[model samples]
Target: MEKIAAIIGGGVIGGGWAARFALMGWQVRVFDPDPEAERKIGEVMANAERALPMLYESPMPKRGEITFHDTIAEAVVGATYVQESVPERLEIKQKVYAELQKHVAENAVLASSTSGFKPSELQEGAARPQQILVAHPFNPVYLLPLAEVVPGQASLEVIEKASETLRDIGMYPLHIKAEIDAHVADRLLEAVWREALWLIKDGICTTEELDDAIRYGFGLRWAQMGLFETYRIAGGEAGMKHFMAQFGPALKWPWTKLMDVPEFNNDLVDLIAGQSDDQSGHMSIRELERLRDNNLVAMMRALKGQEAAAGKLIRDHDARLRGPLADEVPLVTVRRTVPVDWVDVNGHMNEGRYGQVFSDASEELMAHVGADRAYIDAGNSYFTAETNIKYLDETLVGEEFFVETRVALGEGKKLRLLHEMKRASDGAVLSSCDQFLLHVSLETRKSCPPLPDVLAAVEALADKHAG
Candidate 1:
């Protein structure tokens, strides 16, 4: 059965939540009064469609339906999850929650996308307050993996379920044991933001320089290793304790205005905004979003290989989502829409990536017949001896396609495979590959026959294909 996610606002965060849920195969109902909600949400989805899939090799679930509802009741009617992304005002949020109880099921998890508002504050004066928890997601929710799950007067069950649900959909849910003012990541962000404001207010550094300090400095390490862990490595073999001990005195240093506020006067505001403009004002907002998404995709892909931090979430979930399969028909081994990150300077799927696609399909075929990870671990695996790829048509970003693979031959020590990469919209062959592999014993590092069971499975698939 298809799942339904009710989104109660259509602004950036709400729209982001919608995109995240919808892309994860949950039919999403969005309720908002803004006339421009669809256009704005569409823009967010466009960016998401290009970026999210690049993080995984396996096929994503089929995209679910998105409907803009006229009312909150209409939206939450059969929703399994109701996410409120309205403005941060308490009264406004409570009113929506009050109306929500009448339509949404008691079992449905109610989540708020409020960045700063604690779950307690959000649930205050609201009906069925225990159901409302803060599932605060970062901006560009589809691309970013972190979703802070903060419970109010809710059950641990709710928190666990919410966390698991978010994890299943490629998010890293950080559970807050105590309901603080701001959730974990945001609290750290606030400290940094406060100091940055003071710096700009005092003309200590321009907005660009401050940004460079982050992006060009510890930001890269912090992306995967995080603060204390990076510092632990800095401490050498002494570890986190030694690092903390060495730097503990700096906590009281008067270096940062972390607790102080810069008055939001017109002069400071103008200086910050003007400097920000001079730094990145040339690019439009959409262009900037694309740029950000591209950088994030590249960085995340690098991390995925290392199974580090958020990339590890993608890696783990992808493993659970896939397993060995045996198929006869040119099996649809790869089904995915092209990601913008796949595009090259010529504005199409880069030629090298086509080779990657073919390689992935061949790997999938290898797995299908039990010649997978365990087989490789057992010191016997297929080594590609030859491959021929022919690109028939130009493939572009966001274009849905599938690779239908067939085992042409499955002899004792060798196998031959053919993969037809076709566009999903129309059965047009985008590319084709013929791959020949020689099974080898890892111990001997020479040509050898696959194990009996793997050999049987391969021959079975080849026989089925031939039939």
Candidate 2:
């Protein structure tokens, strides 16, 4: 059965949550009072259109449709999961839960996206009290995979089921041992903010300087090793215990105000905003968010490719994995974009470009034929017989084109392929080629039939999409 999730609210956070679930292949039903929800969600989905597919090395699962509902009851009726991202007021949450209680099925898991409230408070008026829990996610939920699971006085079985569902949708859910206002992450963040404010009040480093200190220095390490792990490694022959022993004494230093809350005075607010304005300078919030996301995707993918232990574990465990092939057909998996080396003086993709394109297509086809580099070195090779190319559009340097190939004809010793090239940005068809290939025994350098299994696999794919 197709999985369905109902989201209550359509603000930025709700829309992001919707996109995250939808991209992971869950049909989303969203109920929001705002009449402009559809438009707002459309924008959010468009952003995901570019971002989600680029997050992995393999193609992602097909995205599910998003349906808008006028009433909470309509949204919750058949949904297997319900995510309530309503306003923060207690009354509003209670009322939403009351309405949700009457409609959601007994088996459906109910989650509130409240950042501050404990689950007990949100579930106070919930009819199906045990099913309601906190599934608080970080901002830009589509990009960040972390979600804190705060269960009320609910059955352990229900929380386990909810955790499993969250995993299926590609999230890492950390269950809180006991619920508290703001939970674990926010409490850490609050302490950092309080110290940051004190710094600004005391006229220390400017906001941009503070940001640079983190991003350029420790922020890079935080992505792969995290705070404690990085420190553990820094402890030399000793471990976390020794490191803590060495650094614990410094905790008492007046370097930071860990316990004190900054007064929200006029001068402090203005000072913070002024520093923020200086730090941001020209880039708008949307621009900064995009910059952050793009960098995160690139960095994370790079670390994953290196098989860094932490990255590898995260990729293996945190379920909703997606890659390049998810968004479009990967004709070739080149390491980098077409560079100046591949361009002609006319500033267009050079004649050598077609060869590069053909080579990539050939490799992918070989990957299908069991004649890849390793196979070739092991005495199997695929040689091109003839290639007929028709360039339909001019491609410039740095433009990315993915080719899709179909085995037009395949017999005992010869395979015919039809390839179409498309521009990644506009999905414009740029060129096409029809080619014939001969499998050869590399040591003898003569034509041969592909291995029985290879032939069968190729024939199966060719038969299915012989364009």
Candidate 3:
């Protein structure tokens, strides 16, 4: 059966949730009270159109259609998952939950994208609390894969099932042992945010300076390895125990007030927002989000090559969120054995030249999309944002091999591509490269929606592999 997910609210967070599930190939139905929901959701989707494909090297899954619903009940009809992102008011949330319980399918999991409220509060009067839990996602849900699942007295089996479902969609679901306000990740972030506020209020640093310290230092470490792992590494040859023992004495320093209360006064808010304005100068929020996602795509791509946790996330994402399949896009013929130069010192195919074969295949894809030299001359081109490869067999010099490119997902401004590298002689599988690329406007250095003809071609490619 085809998996489907429904989104309610259609605000920034709702739009992100819609894009996240939709890009992963789930049929999505969105319902929102906002009269201008379409325009706002369109903006959010536009950003995702460019960012989602760049998250991996391979093609993404064929995106399901996004259907707009006039009411919440209409949206949840046959959904496997229901993500609620309505306004934060408790009574409003309660009302929405009541309505959702009536319409959402019995077997479907219901998740709330509430960051501040506990699941217990949202599920207080829920008819199916066991299936209702928190699947809180960070703001830019399409890009960030972390999904903190906080179950509210829900059955363990239900929680696990929900987590597994989320994992299938390329998310890292951290199941909290017990229900708590804000849960794990948000609590940790709150601590840091509180401290940052104190530092700013005390005139210790500007907003930009605080951001610099985090991003340039610990942020880089945290990307591939979490805080605990980094600390364990810092402990050196002695390991975590010995390292902690040696550095335990420094804990007594009066450097931080971990328990200090923070006052969210208007003056403080104005000061911070003003400082932020000065730091960013004139870029709109959309522009900043785009820039941030591009950097994240690049960073995550590098991590994928190293086979790190983040890299594994990208792989899981590719396997689940496949792009439009290029089965009908007649396979290009390559009849040569692997050249000696193609095999690096490691006795496997080098990473760089995987592009050469893929690039040759991409020519067909570009032509299929109407992006020929004329398109390039018109200031449009495709840029590789990310790629992940799995080496299954070692190919030595003179080992016959051939590669085939297939469209795994195609939509909006991005495309997910999958390539199979196999030995030509015995037909042994060699490797696979999964990539995400953006259809970019060279002049703007930003993504532009594919033209109608190009979009039509993409739809044809996607349709040929719909099964």
TM-score computed on alpha carbons, candidate 1? 0.95
lDDT (0 to 1) per candidate: 0.86, 0.77, 0.78
1-467: candidate 2 lDDT, tens digit per residue = 98999999989889998998898789999999899999998888876655655544334557899999889989986898888898889899989988888888988888988999998998786677898899899877887777899998767877998888887866778999799999998988888788888887888888888888888998788877778899998888988889999999998888887678778999888888887887786897668767766675667556756776334644664333522221222334332234334557888778666766766676666675565668777887778889988888887754555677777777777887777778877878887888888888887899998888778866765776654
Q: Pick the candidate with the highest lDDT.
A: 1
Poorest lDDT segment (10 consecutive residues) of candidate 1 = 321-330
> Which 10-residue span in candidate 2 carries the lowest summed lDDT?
322-331
Q: What order do you get sorting by lDDT, best first? A: 1, 3, 2
True-vs-predicted CA distance for residue 246, candidate 2, Å: 1.8
RMSD of each: 1.9, 6.0, 15.7
Candidate 3 C-alpha error for residue 19, in Å: 0.5
Query: Which regions of candidate 3 are displaced past 4 Å?
Result: 319-329, 332-467
Name the candidate that leads on TM-score.
1
Q: What ranges in model 2 sit over 4 Å off?
A: 57-60, 308-402, 406-419, 424-428, 431-452, 455-467
Error of 3 at 356 (Å): 4.2
Task: Give the clashing residue pairs of candidate 2, or none.
Answer: 56-323, 59-325, 59-326, 60-326, 170-320
Better of 1 and 3 by TM-score: 1
